[model samples]
Target: MVVQNATENSIKIMKNLKLKIRKTILIVFVSFFSIFSTYAQFDGVFSHYMHNLSLVNPSYAGENNMIQASLFQRTQWIGMPGAPIMSVLSVDTPFKLLERQHGVGVQFLSDIFGVFNNQQVKLLYAYKYKLGKGHFSFATNIGMINVICNADSINISKLTTDDGYHSDNDPAIPIGKQTGVGFDLGFGLNYVSDTYSLGASLTHVNSPIISIGDKNEFNVLPLMQVNGAYRFPLDRDNGKYKINTNVLFLTDFAVWTSHLSSILEINEKYWAGVGYRYQDSFSIQFGLELFDGFRLGYNFDIPSNRLILNTFGSHEVFATYEFSLVRQKSNSTKSIRIL
Candidate 1:
């Protein structure tokens, strides 16, 4: 495909660009890690790669030409007290009406962080347009997010005895739980051809205002995820080998930023790969594509730097299923999922 060829050529250019941008990366990393350790924050990563249909790019919803459902679970820094537990369930499908291709998606997500919890329900809508024999799609998602904080997790003894709020019966901290509501908006663009695809997205547009406790003063930062991926087939047809690579950069308004991760995947019934996360993390992922286009994937993040000293590795699992309603000759995307 022309897109594939162009990207291959562009990689050489990008490699150079990466080097030239060293100062930005270094500054971002230093600013990020320094603030990461000092925060009592919500867990990120509830939406993993597969469930990322809309999270990755709004236009990516239903890119595979079928109604799809995906779910993901991630437990970060296992064995560590107060580790994060998160999950996301997503469904998306494509349809044609009046000669227009449209996609819709809905997601339910929940994340728990120490004493804090967040639940969100989102709706996504996308439209597809043809561009020089390829399909270009753009989409937007808007929904509501609810946050809950459990005061029971706080230790009264841990606080300094002060008349300001040291009393366990103090009204500011809220002895039980508190709740708040907010809204979110996200948008994405995707370009998909016969052999390759690329996408970009921006999430958390409204910057939800959630004040969990009476005394807590800080607000949560609106997060961002910028990612792109490419696939290279070794041959034009009947290819036994192919490489899928991707890069993801995540940042918050605060100093916490994850040094983007690079992922490489090999396609087959059973595949294995590894990823290196620059923010002191590493991951190895494996997957199996079973019958009826069902897929199961897993990844383990190896602790690095200071994190390794406090906890065991992190683990994640993903599952997805997609099938055609009618027995029509399927396209490349459908074929790959079936395998």
Candidate 2:
């Protein structure tokens, strides 16, 4: 017995070492790729992506067969000047016309990063096809984005000589607010089944060019996203408690990032979860349901990178409400399959 235990321990140590080595290699490779291939400017990042699925993927609109409205807000890098702040509002509904399932939605987003701000309005359309017990959905998006830059607000006097902030007298710097407008397009596909959901989307498919200040043009590249989630019930009888495992992968024609999380929900009322963003941060999430259809959620992020030195953390909040206008023939026996 003593000999067998020693052999098992050795094997465990070897496995752990191999895992660590693989993780280290992966991090190095991703960092290298990010430094070399990245070109598109950073977009607004969100923590509660699971709750705001339709914001990223149009196909998720009206997937629950109900009228739904949601709101999301995020403040990144607490206590840091010129950090990113963003908010979005969206509403979607399903309608059947001529024996076909169709959905329509609208979204408005306001994002501010440093002296740059972008406001966008989008209209979404989706068609759903039923296949056995599941559904396949295709969606398209049409939108316009207004980009504004406040060049005059930049303060250069506070900068140190070593910090390289000496653009105060530059002739190219616009003296006032510079604005530009661009058209945006996107497409998405989503599949939903009894136990799992999967989706993929591409945004800014045309690489819209927005000229901010004079002679300065920015290209908004296509952003790719792939996400999946699976539900596991603790008890088969009532399903009062269940676990949801989710993963989201994203690329902006530059670098890649991912978020992985596991959440526990009880009686469809309360939920808690923990998640890790690849080479980014760890997050704690909490949520509650109220009054049948209203939901509130919050998330806190603890950065693992160099930003942790003087920053406290990031915060995000979201709310959603869902309601059905008319009852279906099998409403009593149907289950909620929304993301």
Candidate 3:
């Protein structure tokens, strides 16, 4: 009788645990859908946001004192139909004029999901001034955002018609491909030191409006972000090993999210890390410095909610290169013929 009771108690505990999990997943999905339904245009989230700081903050351009270029790509919600795919290419360089430091950069982004495509190009400029222990940068960006919708590809039959509405005759739905373009603006401030950094930025400051069709339009909402990072040396003598912690917070005034990450660096050549996105996913990340001035990284996200049932996960990869324009002087003089 005791053995039978023990088995019964085990089964009951398992059932209760499953019930709790279901309730949590339902709450997450409802919250996500409610927030997304209210926004027409939203920025894509990146798991490797630490390396793509310039994408959100213009002041990050040229902060490294070297010419830098990067490419990044992400595929979200694997195995799910019409999942989001995004890519970005960006370059930045520092220059001096009239004994004052300045930065300039350009970025291109392409994002696609479902039947819609978004492309953007932006030019960034930043002015830097010396502060207490680090430099402060003030920056701005101007860009053009273009959106295209393949309205013909949308299946009208799949849409619900329960409100005494005919999907085929709805004038709000475009009968063909529709495109719209709008001007975008952003501003940022950043402070960086040898061991730490902090930044804040605002995207879509102008709240650009793009009209896709006669009745359909997109109202771009402004997003605010605050980010910071700190470094701790594990080996003080040689500084061969270290730990870096990063955090980012984002909001549109209605919905908010946060990301936290910590990474361990080995000999400045390789690193591994883990990250968490609040109410979303946990991620594993690793990377290496392939060669001088070049690095590559990858991140994989595991869903923390019901998305795990429908999708495998998300994947991201990024590559970056940095180099200085000034040539290094040779230690010894060389013959003209050898040169």
Q: Compare the candidates by TM-score and give the number of the best one.
A: 3
Tens digits of lDDT, candidate 3, 1-339: 999999999999996776565555434433332333244445887888787588778988877677889999999999986677999999998899999999999999988866667889999999999999888999999999998777666454344233233445666555678888999999999988778889999998999987877777757889998989888789899989988898889887778889999988887779899999999899999999798778899999999999999999999999988777787473222110000
TM-score of 3: 0.83
Which ranges of candidate 1 are over 4 A from the true structure?
A: 1-43, 46-52, 153-165, 169-172, 213-218, 235-237, 256-267, 330-339
lDDT for every model? 0.65, 0.78, 0.79
For lDDT, candidate 1 versus 3, the one ahead is 3
Error of 1 at 38 (Å): 8.6
* Model 3 CA deviation exceeding 4 Å by range: 1-40, 155-165, 329-339
* Overall local distance difference test of candidate 2: 0.78
Segments in model 2 whose C-alpha atoms lie over 4 Å from true places? 1-40, 155-169, 327-338
Error of 1 at 294 (Å): 0.4
Spell out the clash pairs found in candidate 3: none
Model 1 vs truth, CA RMSD: 17.2
The TM-score values for the models, in the order shown, are 0.77, 0.82, 0.83
Report the candidate with higher lDDT, 2 versus 3: 3
Q: Positional deviation of 187 in candidate 1, in angstroms? A: 1.5
Model 1 pairs whose backbones collide: none
